[model samples]
Target: MTEFNDKQIDILQAAEKLFAEDGYDGTSIRTIAKEASVNIAMISYYFGSKEKLLEALIIHRTSGMKIQLENIFKEDLLPIEKVERLIDLYISRINKNKCMYQILHFELSTKKRIMDMNAFKDVKYENLQAFTKIIKEGQELGHFRKDVNITLIPPTIMGTLVHFQMNKPFFEPVLGIKTEEEYENYIKNELTAHIKQTIKALLVHEN
Candidate 1:
């Protein structure tokens, strides 16, 4: 992972917020500069161009998760335990970086391409590779089903979280979630448990 100075971190955060609010095409380098309280030249100096800035921001936000996923395999735990830890790690990261995740979701859902898709997909693939390693370990241990479709695991986890995020307003009212804190707690606890349980069922061998 790349180590960013305070200025670079500020600029990336500013870009993240702007991208989430205004969409990538609607935001400009000048807007990010103002948001970060830095000159336009600073962004150019650090990231070169808008496309590179977006790529850097995506990498900055996601690289930690990928690293953590890789580190999970080194921990002293059963394969199933490692998988559950991955579920928790993902939920916590997504919850903390809501703006960045929202930016990614918006870019993916829209027809107009604003950011570099390949960069985004590359980060995702790295994370998936780490995740697949755990699943394969479990399969080798006779803990997970051999026939499980490993490719679908990421989507199963990400798609459910995306659906919950997109439909929060509907879900909040239906679930009687009356406050922001309540909704966040529900996501971190209830939603995380649900996803862990779902994945466990999908991956675990039948009794």
Candidate 2:
């Protein structure tokens, strides 16, 4: 991941917010500059183009997760504990970066070419590999079942969280959420616990 200065971070964040709300085609470089309180030239100087800006934002948001997942492998915890930590890490990251995920879902759904698709896919693949490494270690250690579908685990975690976020308006009422804090707590607690339990069930072999 490329290092970004304060101004660059500001521009990327502005782009993320606009891209989530207005769609990539709807958002312009000028709009991002205005939102960031910087000039168009600054955005151009920092990112080179709108497409590059989107690329930078995508990498900026996702690169950290891959690094964190790799670091989890170094921890002295049990395999299942590490898996639980991975779940918590993902839930926490998605909850915090809802807008970025929203932009990704929309862009990928529409099959847009606004950003570098290969770069996006590379990040995703790397993250999946990191996750698969943990699962393989668990299997080798006789903690997790050998039959676990490595490919499905990433989507299972990501899809569930994305679904909850994208359909929040509907789910909030159904779940009896009334305030912002309450909703946040529900995600941090109930939602995280649910995902952990679900994944553990899939991986843990019954005696």
Candidate 3:
């Protein structure tokens, strides 16, 4: 498990918040230091540089996901059930780690090369490969469509969740959402159900 002192965690949390608000390129070491309530040298000492800090943040956010997915795979359940569990797991994690998810989506959409760098590429590939195995196994078991593109499924799932998350301000009035708790409930329940149904349809829909 990746471990961080309380101060390191504070710095990371501050960075995540700043990255969400300011964009990665716009946020600087000085800003992070101030937000984190640490001196500039402390960040440099703990994380080396801004790039390495970003990498550490990614690692911290994603380190648990692969293991969780692997354990879900080991469960004695049907392929569709496993897929449903995976969906729930993802939605739960993403909601809890919204900042990390936002940062990840931002980097992927605008700074593709950053995701491919040595820092994040392995974890990304490992996650993709793990999900690929799940889908392939489902196909082999005659549970999922053989023609489904496993490569696209992860992005599709993530994009759907991120869209709903990032558009809450625009959607709230339109969708009749009134309060933060209600909006969170909508995501935790209704939106999650929507994603589950959507994924199920995609996996089983006739081509």
Q: Which has the greatest lDDT?
A: 2
Judging by TM-score, tell me the better candidate of 2 and 3.
Answer: 2
The best candidate by TM-score is: 2
Q: Please, what is the TM-score per model?
A: 0.91, 0.93, 0.87
- The residue-by-residue lDDT of candidate 2 on 4-64, one tens digit each, is 8999999999999888888888999989999999999998888899988888888888776
Candidate order by decreasing TM-score: 2, 1, 3
How do the residues 1-207 of candidate 3 rate in per-residue lDDT, one tens digit apiece?
Answer: 267899999999999999989988899999999999999999999999887788889888876678888988889988888888988888888889899888877787776454425546677688787777788788898889988978887777788888998998898999899999999999888888888888888887476
Model 3 ranges with Cα > 4 A deviation: 1-3, 112-116, 205-207
Query: How many clashing pairs does model 1 include?
Result: 0
Query: How many clashes show up per model?
Result: 0, 0, 0
Q: What is the per-residue lDDT of model 1 for residues 15-43, given as tens digits with 9 covering 90 to 100?
A: 99898888888999999999999999999
TM-score of 1: 0.91
TM-score of predicted structure 3: 0.87
- lDDT of each model, Cα atoms only? 0.87, 0.88, 0.84
Q: Who is ahead in lDDT, 1 or 2?
A: 2
